[model samples]
Target chain A: MPDGGDPTALGFRPALETVIPLARAGPIMLRVGVNGYGTIGKRVADAVRAQPDMEVAGVAKTRPNFEAERAVAKDFPLYAAVEERADQFGEAGIDLAGMVEELVETADVMVDATPSGIGAENKSLYEEHDTPALYQGGEDEDLVDTSFNARANYADAAGADHVRVVSCNTTGLSRLVAPLEEEYGIEKVRATLVRRGGDPAQSGRGPINDILPNPRTLPSHHGPDVKTIFPDLAIDTLGLKVPATLMHTHSINVTLDSDATADAVRDLLRDESRLFVIPERLDIDGAGALKEFALDAGRPRGDLWENCIWGESITVEDDDLYLFQAIHQESDVVPENVDAIRAVTGSADAAESVATTDDALDMGF
Target chain B: MPDGGDPTALGFRPALETVIPLARAGPIMLRVGVNGYGTIGKRVADAVRAQPDMEVAGVAKTRPNFEAERAVAKDFPLYAAVEERADQFGEAGIDLAGMVEELVETADVMVDATPSGIGAENKSLYEEHDTPALYQGGEDEDLVDTSFNARANYADAAGADHVRVVSCNTTGLSRLVAPLEEEYGIEKVRATLVRRGGDPAQSGRGPINDILPNPRTLPSHHGPDVKTIFPDLAIDTLGLKVPATLMHTHSINVTLDSDATADAVRDLLRDESRLFVIPERLDIDGAGALKEFALDAGRPRGDLWENCIWGESITVEDDDLYLFQAIHQESDVVPENVDAIRAVTGSADAAESVATTDDALDMGF
Candidate 1:
């Protein structure tokens, strides 16, 4: 009876603990409204719907464009983001859920995806409805109480009124940094980001045939942005804008506080669900091939939600570590946006939320 | 008269050095035959024509196309690379300067810019004719006895049977490194190359919208290639391919042997004629803006022969140094090829050939 009760069976004193299903532990059907139903917003809405604890309350867009049409086709309630532009939807014969105000009022949390400065401008509207909001990376860091990367500083976001998910590049760096800092402790980090000039659909942004230093300066805004997450972490980032539209490839070097081997570092990165350590045998050369690989795998919209890190590139020289990783700018943050919802609402801890989000999105490859 | 040559007037022991006309110092009317007159070949032909000691013996093309037409229009003697395809030149109403064999036999040196491995295959022909040859960066490092960067190893190339001008990115790096290594003594270098997908006319090449790890591995060939010029130098390079075809931008980090201020470093880089320190007042944002600036400045073919280093980006933290520089892929190596001709001929020292090449091409911005 003592052995069956496990008190005697366990050699060490077993701590009494209960494991719960991660699915609905976070929330009970938390309604989420996503504004700016473009590349990221639509994906977030779909991801939110897939979460057992969350559901899409509605989506807001300025026009009844193709993306809005697709949102409607997905059975997502669509609302006009700009109240004055509501009639344009009716003129286009599109069904409407309500104005953005009603969507904000009904939602437990609002995810703002407005381009750049507009996210800050939309902050007041969310506050007026007393609905805590999540902002994308493009907005100014000062606008939010805290910048969130689930793996890096998830707890900092708990119950925060306005939390911003760092940009795709920042998110990728944060995820990589989190495990490295935890395992070995970091001395400093140096990263060079070769950024895509534009999204695939965006034809306007380009050098078309040239690489540009994004800021043509050292510690290009990214380092300061990363500091917003791990405020004390020493980092320097350089950026180059290239013609690529697929993903942002990062050349990363981290100086660890303690000596570590390449294999150990690879193992650590592999343990991270968000960091996909690309194996040698796969023979995936570049982003072009990576996208093709994604399409072949039948991923949604051919999206890669994880940082596709090359395994062999994870090399350690003394206490210094070096590797190359690609961040799918359009979609890496989609899952982060999902995790931010749980983080900002105090519904789930980092582990449960990351696991649940990964499970819901089929995150690991 | 006292100040001109007297050690007493100088107040210091003056090492006597001779000043001579840099022009025509390298070779006595050296005849140079250019092979594969495409993006690099045609530009080299133009640059060679501008050198006082050099003359274009002829140029060979596999096909009589637009570039061939441009070569012929520029009065560069044109020849058929493939004997079987000789009729193509005649069919295109282009006058032939005879077969590639005739050009190789007549010229003192053959500059082979044939696609990658093709340059190696053409190497034996140059040796057969007992003609010294200069190969472009695309050729394997083993193909050349010495890899030439006029500023770094001009003397090494002297009297060498074959020399390879390191690639555009490598040339830019070497030029930057030469001064740094000379002044501060370099401990190590880490460079990330954001490469263009293709040459401007090359519509076939692209991620078009994706960034890719060129090798998806550590120590991309660039570091090894740079080592070809600086054999003892420790360098680790990573490469990313982007949609831009205009140029390749490099994010550079060097751990110097000594601590230095950014101002002193800037002044040193400014003294190097091949390094164009882009002043902040220029307001050039990226490669696109840089190209427009080039055209406006009346640069021939808008060619940027110098490494365009952003002045403000240069920073020093402890012993670490960082900056960003852009390499105009199509034309940066043009002047290097010109210097290699002089170096191989044992005509000029590093200072002489570099100044000669710079003066001939109107190199500095």
Candidate 2:
């Protein structure tokens, strides 16, 4: 009887006006469908679910592997990425809602998590469904309307139909550069990326026992990618693939337009939501221990969502700012994906979305 | 008569001039005593013995510990660093040639390898013995006439009574900066030292789980130490203590007065005798793997004597050069100590001494 007073049970009592909760009636929960279900894809789905006003519509997978089983266990409705391979899910005992196309059409937004080149191919399908999609860093810039980094260019992505979250290294660099460019005005930037040989799950690739210049060229492609965000920002990046699999460490040196102290730069970066200036007390010095700390903290997949900057490593002399920072290769882009979803869908403004995402994920760990 | 024409051995006649072969002894082998039989001291003794123009006068130790045992195993005459402890060695059954004072008086030059502050205290002992000494990086620059990095300013140390081989970090930075400054004029330099919490053998130090800004100040002593070599070079340095103990990695950024390509910078570094540009095919990526490769390749203590610069990590854009390089804290300074001995004694000029030391040590590994 407490569920809602019935007028008939109250005899001649005047019919009471039924009131519906505004949260339940105001707007439909935004459904976000994720495709690919790989390293970036799996993280994106979890981040999407973390938003207060959003719900994961479903996740599409190519095969009914462990990840698919994981998706089911996490209670995410699974869909088939390839129609021809749909029966594989049933064989694996993972029930699918439908094909990837149905999920794409059903959701208000889709995050394309396919391998690098494959994102370009899936763009047409996103267009067909008229669903706004976010792409991962592996895809080229031209594949999307604009490359996205929550802290760097959130406003630029507002209402855009498709956005690409930059790579882990790019996200890491963008986060550092954004604060410098805004507060100090960057003159030019130079960064050397000590990249991981491969992600933890990637077993077959490597230089294994050797050191090689990846492109064997001056200024790797990363510089151009940074340019995509700050088109006028002068930057050059050198790449090295080390045997480590946990994270990518960056040696960054930036020349600001004007002089700034190392302390000032540290203070500026600390204010940004995505940059985690590692304090001297934590002793999270190298990538090995940093990853171990993450795992010990019970982070899902041991993800460190913020750029880990060595606090004491920030040194400024004259107009130069020098520092060492590590980027979690797998999960830095995860939070960016959440922010980009809001940016592309106009669900929230930059500040609100960034704050909400940062709060929900508990960044700066 | 292969044995001097002895009829009991063979019937061969010996020429009267055959006895003149002793004249080929050339220059008297410079007797170099290593005072402080710890990490750098022990290595310096071995390096001196390896030189065709030099020999280890003797090694001095403060304790009859494992290192003393190892010194004896290597057939090095051991002298007690502390006179009070001299009897302890005799009690421990370590046969000593004499006291540390006797070793200093016997040698033409002495290399002080004591702890940082103790090196400064040992200055009077060497001076009393009239033996010019080469100090390790631990001592203050004022403790010596000049700080020496063999590649940076070998000529400056020639005939100087006191020459301090710069610290492992400084030596590492100087090795990189010297080539860049010579090939292309350097307007300014910035470096970040990702320092080891302690050497591999230091069991008592560290946050173990924390990264600390060692001095918590801008422009660590490293920048000033660099100024000792390049007085006019403008530089700033930041220091961070990480958990790793194997080696210290440096993130170096230099602003050149002119332009240069990645290949050009790499070629210039490659030509230097002490700088080892890790080739692309070897896959020597991180400090961990680099150490492993060295150990697997049978390097003594798995020491990488040369600056381990990743070939592909060198990038030049406009007037800025950036790269990542690792300095094996233990042995990089070993070769420098040998060269410093030659410089202080005026035994050889820069090129000949560097070449001799490099060749003897089988450098560029």
Candidate 3:
């Protein structure tokens, strides 16, 4: 009934009525190939398998490791890189029909989770096979047809062959920035990124005992990197390194041309369905509690894969506005990756894909 | 002369006369007892020695190690805290007299760079000895008489015995927030902290490859922490952790009550002596280049160690404003620490110390 109307209402337009039913469309079949089965690739594969409409057709790993062996046990068709000996997978008792290139050719879509520079190369492999591929945030902004966020720019990737998910930092920044840009004409944007040195697995990170300026540069290009998504928008960025690692936090300042109260801005943000403005109440403890809540909610990832804005921090002064929000890079992009898969396949209506994705995310905090 | 008057032609009043030549402030002797020789403590010691008006009278390490031995070679008195064994400092070949309590009593000022929760315990020691001490940003804001910033509130530390330097994140936030707050009354503030899992040496920190929401709580009290410095401030903060070692960055949004052009705001910041707004020119590269420049400048600790604001990023539409700046925590606090030493010693005029400290900083893109 939240649809607010009967499909057979007398004044109903046929086109609108026809699309309404798409909301209940059954899941579509998807053949997904995952390359570079590291942290992100593995997660992507697991998430795809969870979606009723999608399935992991195959997966490719650079080397035969315990992780690769586990993927094989999961029955994911495994493939090794050509650079490695073809018999490597066979030696590990993991059968491979062919190389990673063959894996790319077999899937309807590919998800590239290689290291920064490697994603672009993997992207080319997908293109050579005439298969649409999704690239993670590690690649430079210029490599993709579009950097996709289901809520922000899902439609932009509707018919594109290549889509890049903005860097985790960019994804968070863009999600927060896009809404502001749409509601208020953004004149310029400023942000500072507190980044982690390395993951627990990457123990080689440094100056751990000391806090240092990661980039002595003023206005790190991260601001401009955001423009790859919203061209013609003006923005700038600054960055620093700290000794904590759950997410990248940003301190943003936005200058507006029109006078608006902080409350008005907060209201605008709250109105967005995809965005979650953390309530002033609840008083959830720390990032740890928030993560637990997300997990309890059965969110694809523990925290909001989408942008989570803090309600209390939202403020407005004359035309200037300030507020804080967090973005879960890993999960935020998952939904987008799902949508991108649907977009490439053209197997389901856009409206249906979005509705299904949103409904699935309803179980999330 | 830049003094704009004859050496004494200005018919100096008693207020204008000097008790001691600015150059002859007798190297305000400072015995720095660093209990935890970690990232922040090491930087503080290095910064203290770099100051012409300050010296490292003594230093201590929590445990014996190559780092501790290095401190000893630097002529720093080292100590061990193995229960009663720590008391051996008095008998050591070096001048390691007294317990941490005695060390606090001997030092004109003590910099508590211990981990969080430790600073609060050491407060009583400083109070008992009537010795002024500086605590790191990790301590609760209320613990110190004031949070000192050489450029923003150097004068507040004037006659106070205890001052707290805000955390690296807060320091960065304060640097950007102060300017905006002064120019326009802030109605509210929201920030996203893109925090790193760990520093280079801190490999044990984090969710590793996972990105998580920190302090799932709304209004991470970071804003309140900031208010410890500006009690009446209307601000709130949200935090996130990402898998990167670079620096923590913030994306800030501000809503203002009045209409102002972005140019007007940028001009105001550009004029501030302590702020180095990156000029539109110089095509300064990324964070790496900036870091290199800082080191090349012969900066005692390398990099600006200050808030480096970007020029072109300043933009305003109607009443909104936006800009970005980078804050080097370890070094940013160095200047403030140096100034605090002078204030506690009363060896130089407060105004002189403020001016010299401000001038001594290499504020630029």
Top-DockQ structure, candidate number: 1
Q: For candidate 3, lDDT tens digit of each residue in A229-280?
A: 7777677666655444444455556767667777788888887655677786
Q: Which ten residues in a row have the lowest lDDT in candidate 1 chain B?
A: B12-21
Q: What ranges in model 3 sit over 4 Å off?
A: A1-28, A81-84, A99-106, A117-119, A122-129, A140-144, A177-188, A199-222, A240-246, A252-304, A308-321, A358-363, B1-365
DockQ of 1: 0.58
Each model's TM-score, in the order given? Answer: 0.87, 0.80, 0.60
Best by lDDT: 1
Candidate 1 on A51-120: residue-level lDDT in tens? Answer: 9888999999999889988888999999999978999999998999999988988887899987888899
* Cα lDDT tens digits for candidate 1, B1-365: 01123434654212112112233344357789999998889889989999988899999999888988888888998999999999988999999989999899888778999888899999888876767789989888888888888889888876566789889989999999999999999998988888888877888987666777777767789999899989999888888777777778888999899979999999999999989999999988777787888999898878898998899999887788999888899889999899888777666777888889999988777
State how far residue B158 of model 3 sits from its true place (Å): 8.2
Model 1 misplacement above 4 A? A1-27, B1-27, B61-63, B66-102
**Relative to the true structure, how large is the alpha-carbon lDDT of every model?**
0.85, 0.79, 0.64
lDDT of 3 by residue, B256-328 (tens): 5666677777787776655667675755433344556677877755646666666665655445454545555
DockQ for model 3 equals 0.13
Q: What is the lDDT of candidate 1?
A: 0.85
Model 2, C-alpha of B154: deviation from truth (Å):
3.2
Q: Give each prediction's root-mean-square deviation over alpha carbons.
A: 9.2, 11.0, 10.1
After TM-score superposition, the amount by which residue B89's alpha carbon in candidate 2 deviates from its true location, in angstroms, is 4.9
Q: Could you tell me the TM-score of candidate 2?
A: 0.80
Question: CAPRI verdict on model 2?
Answer: incorrect
